[model samples]
Target: MPVAFRLPLQVFYEREARHPRQPFLVQPIGGGAVQTLTWGDVGHQARCAAHWLRARELPQGSHIALISKNCAHWIIADLAIWMAGHVSVPLYPNLTADSVTHVLQHSEAVLVFIGKLDDWPTMAPGVPAGVPTISLPLCPAGDFDYRWADLQGCSPIQDDPLPPASALATIIYTSGTTGLPKGVMHSFGALGFAATHGTELFGLGEGDRLLSYLPLCHVAERMFVEMASIYTGQTVYFAESLDTFLTDLRRARPTALFGVPRIWTKFQMGVYARIPGKRLDRLLRLPFIGKRVGHKVLAGLGLDALRIALSGAAPVPEALLRWYQRLGLDVLEVYGMTENCGYSHVCRPGQQKIGWIGLPCPGVEVRIDQAGEVQVRSGATMLGYFKDAQRTAEVLTEDGFLRTGDKGEQDADGRLRLTGRLKEIFKTSKGKYVAPAPIENRLAEHARIEQVCVVGDGLTAPMGLCVLSTVGQPEARHALQDSLERWLEQVNAALDKHERLRQLVVVKDTWAVENGFLTPTLKIKRNVIESTYGPQFQVWSERTEVILWQD
Candidate 1:
């Protein structure tokens, strides 16, 4: 199957020409209002902004940084950058001033676009004094050299300039779970191949709707929402804030929804809050009313129309997957990374395995190397890490496979099941190697545990450091302790002697992006968690109790 690479801009131009009045972006404003932009409207704004960018006389292919939460103008700014023959450098909306400065300097970005953000004051200082800044719509109050409103009045660029397929399009920085974020460079061809083929694999097209809530900086959201929308001519809706996420979702009733494991868990918990899990289970057991009841439940949660429910970024628990299945929703697990344009593998609708990421995508080749690491080669593979040849050489093989650090195994059917990160596997004091991800996944099955990290580098056995979920927080301390102790015993019974957890420690502090315990994508920072709790591991292991609460 040969792929015809169509650059995103070219796709956009074609779509705009065919259906200029079709709604492309729906952005939520305050007071339950929304602003809808047609294909023509979006193209006009992007063209106008492109003219503004061209007026600056920056060097061709200059890096321009964009900082924003998901919004209409973020996409506009991205189009403007690309149309002006500049490369985009998108930073996560939630970043510290130091991190902002580091990425800006490292990427050598000459200009920056500031869009919708909650904490502009803290991050504003990171912009160097001389570098120019432009403010997108809904941006926080700031001193910017240019504003979206001002750019909108400029004459739109006359001609549609389609960048070459092989031209550098964007530099997406990793979430930096371990060290400084590395910039992953992607060509227009790479992004185009992924979006074109990926949407085809999922059978998405013009009529499909998507809600864009995830950070557009991440490759998953970029490929799924931004680039996929370009290829498929899908309508995208933006979420306003956390408080109104459900309301926004309900309004859009997206046909395709993508979420990380944490988001899926939160949705499940939200349903549980309205109707207790046991009560819902009993209702679902009724033959006559069960199907309707399930439909009603999903409709209330704004997922009734969802044709494709995708989960990725981290492993979702098998229990969670089964729970959704009972509700008539098949949450497809996708596997990929920043290096592969997030298009390596996906679980097809009817062929999904419980804990496995499905077969390699149409143009993707996957193999398990001698070290048990999953390596992938695809047309969607990135150009390389921006300005980091040494790091690029370290990951990309001589034969062009991107060496994914994840340890995985393939079944006879070629479905990939990831066990753990190669670097995250730790040796216990007894010289037994332990993979924390599987243990953490099992422990996370409990409704009480919102987050868990299994760590015991030099201890007798691994112990779980957990944070309580909303359901667990309201329970009485004694009852919660009893429940956790029972769960711990149940989990241990299924594990080998060396792999069994010694105890479960409930940490008072929640892991969050703000606190540096989690990456922006909500993956636990192992090094941070270990460093924060390493001093007490021995002390906790010495305790005889099956469950321990942090002071």
Candidate 2:
């Protein structure tokens, strides 16, 4: 279908008005206290906020950055900006002060809406000189410069029309898993098309409810919440906090859900913890017991009622997907980058191939370039990187396809399987090339392992450095270690002799963004991991068995 000419959110409000009393968002503030908003409330809040934004009289294309977690106010603010004819720039809540400043300066944003303050005051200096920053209207502790309630109270702007679909909609910064994050500019038409196409694939329509916990600042959530909701008129419930996530899940009982691979891994772990993996696996192989256990597992996870549960942002362990399938939750693994307005290829419902990100959505054309890199061009592709024309030109081919930077292969069935990052492959000392991803993924398949980083850029053989050994299941640690070693042997056997893992380094505790071992996208920074644990690598390589890194 052609991208709709009208701003998608405007169409959304019309549907909300038609079903004003229907529950739109169910937010749990805490302590079993729930704040529910009907369709009318969402429409009213958005309208009031839009009126306040218009009163500011900013330039037609003024950029406004919203720094916040997922919340009702975030959506209200985003829709208001578009309704009032401006660009919405979303900043990840946990961004460093340096990154915050870089993004604000790069986008030339005039105003900022900060929701919750974790690193804000320190990050404020990054806002650039002369940029007037306003608080995100959230009532958090510490002095706040502005309140969202005040914005709602501002004089109403006579209901003005929304901009056309061709107008600029948003600038989403890349998670910066590699180099400095670049802002990708997307038009309303492209975003709307992706959403509409996704809606068709999922068979979503009015009355569908979506639990919104993923960061609204990211392209995935923008597509799932802003665009998909607009196209399907689905009720979106904003999660209050991580503590209240499970309760919120039961309350909303969402028909559709989206989560990253990490979250899915956690869910898989939770199920195995409840029913021991061995028992569950044995039961799944049985006839009637298999079906009964699967149903029970699905209901326990509150996914029995779900139409679809999607995982994205990283490659999912095929084992985890199989486990969920055993429990009757058909979790679909999707693939797309920030350069594409999030739905490039999605696993077709009931036609899933575990570990493969299924076929491309309708109207999307994907092909492997000569270098084996996946490149795609579609109505959903971003126009270009914001203010980085030279870099944008490098990624976009003369024919208009966007270079995805990921190596892939398309099977006969059109299922796309990711190989590894083109940049992440390194040559070992023995002159054989190694890709750390498959090795790391294979190691992480062990439930005891939480994170893995395969290093040895110039070593005779690559080394697998992992940071996990059963986070609370100490009794299973020894068995877990043995299982992990066996798994590594199987993986190494598959690789060329020189590319095999010489030894495994099981580092205790977790390596996280806060700890500086991993990037914000949860990808391990190989250089950081190697530099911090260089000595451990030397010792582990000399040992025949898997050696645990002791502090």
Candidate 3:
């Protein structure tokens, strides 16, 4: 790792008060131009918003909600919420009205700031009646009690609350893949410590850059993009839309990049589209010219400047890791949950290990319980699930270890390999237990499969129900069947008796957040998958073909 980039929580105050004109946030504007907001600009706008809050005379720790996509105003509102001595509750912009109402009611929020949204009609009804609302400039629908622009003409706050380390910073709700999402509370100390620890691990600073695109409501993106920029003074770029993602990446050319497994897989697919895997494989194996070949490929993907590329939030395929390594990109896999501020473990660069999440972070303690569940304790561990005392008690042990629902094995070398979620391990009709994660990891490398869920709940053996990649259609299935069959055979040979997949059924429909198959953070909803495809499992498993077409 490079020299540790240290910037305390005072970094934000100092940047605004001392170096006011310093570049901070870069916002994408229409007509292809960009807008740069300086620290001074942010401080002023935040002060204005703080004044608005002060005028309202809300309770000292009253909950305020922020619903928006990633944008400059979103961060400003967060800062102002804290400055005004209120706790912020952020909701995913795409959340349904019922979920929105659940959070607003659960958190007891009195005021909300609405911002960029793909669908406002569904999100609007979620706000509880009598709650006041302010609109961020990014909001498309433009319906709100007050516009963020209204704050522009207001005077700056003469005095603001100076919160101590113990003050609550935010309550980030978990992207509910199973049950109702729980709000994970974080103190200012925990958030600051997480950001400082991140800088130590990644060496991010003023010279570095970040692209803000993922939902800001999620802790991973919030930590990496928003908090990191505050603590390290990194310039943050906002992606205009999904269409300009590659363009944004190319323009930012960030030195540090973090993506979930799906993003990395998408990048891999993009590369394969331009250069056939066999041809690219040959180019990398050449003598003396291999390095040049890699440089060109990475530059094409706008990853040439990346010194640190991380993949997490799910299991990454071994084949995908090897594929990137061949192209001179080492994508380290980090593992953590929202309850811990995502600071549990990360694979160190140059000490590469495939199929295992690396050593514990600087101050984090990790252990495997008798149930084989991964438990963690750290300064960054959340205070508790908001307004859910019983649920909090269920997860936290007497001594304070957070019982991560994930089941894993920690090696003597301190690397942890996740097996599956404790509740996700299903027993077959034969009374044999099967862990689907490992098998799914193997199948995820299939070029035609975007996501795969292995199910065997009441069957003799497990079968895969996969949502095809863009090219994973019925026509391509028959052609790719032989190759996939050979690969599945190899994977099955390596697995235990009950873990083997009998067949893979390809589905025609897509799985997305809009379709209710995915969480806001893009993690697949296993329960939804089971409900949608469980009925077809019998027919799929009964088929003689190793890879069967369902659509």
Best-performing candidate as measured by TM-score = 1
- Sum up the clashes in candidate 3: 0
**Alpha-carbon TM-score of each model against the true structure:** 0.98, 0.93, 0.96
Off by over 4 Å in 2: 1-6, 117-130, 135-138, 469-473, 476-478, 519-521, 534-543
- C-alpha lDDT score of every prediction, in listed order: 0.92, 0.78, 0.85
lDDT of candidate 1 over 1-551, digit per residue (tens): 76676778989999989999999999998999999999999999999999988988989999999999999989989999999999999999989889999999999999999999999999999887788898998999978998888888889999988788889999999999999999999999898888878988878888999999989999999999999898998999999999999999999999999999999999888888888888999988899798888888889999999999999999999999988888889999999999999989899999989989999998888888898999999989999998899999999999999999999999999999999999999999999999999989999999888999999899999999999988778889999988899999999998889999999999999899899999988999999999999999999999999899898
Q: Distance (Å) between predicted and true CA of 247, model 2?
A: 1.9
Worst 10 residues of 1 by lDDT: 1-10
Task: Choose 2 or 3, whichever is better by lDDT.
Answer: 3
Residue 488 of model 1: what lDDT? 94
RMSD of each predicted structure: 1.1, 2.4, 2.5
How high a TM-score does candidate 1 get? 0.98
Q: Taking the tens digit of each residue's C-alpha lDDT, what string does model 3 give over 1-551?
A: 32233323356787788778888888887667788999999988999889888888878988999998888888989988988888889999888899899999998899999987788987788888899899988787756898888866679886645777688888999998898999999988788777778767877678888888888889898888888888878888888888888998898888888898889888877887777778888989998788899988899888999888888889999999998898889999988889988889999888778989899988888889998999999878889998889999999998999999999998889999999988889999999988888889998988777898888998989988787675455444457788778878988999988788888776767889899998877788999988988787777777788777665
Off by over 4 Å in 1: none
- Superposed by TM-score, candidate 2 places the C-alpha of residue 141 at a distance from the truth, in angstroms, of 2.1
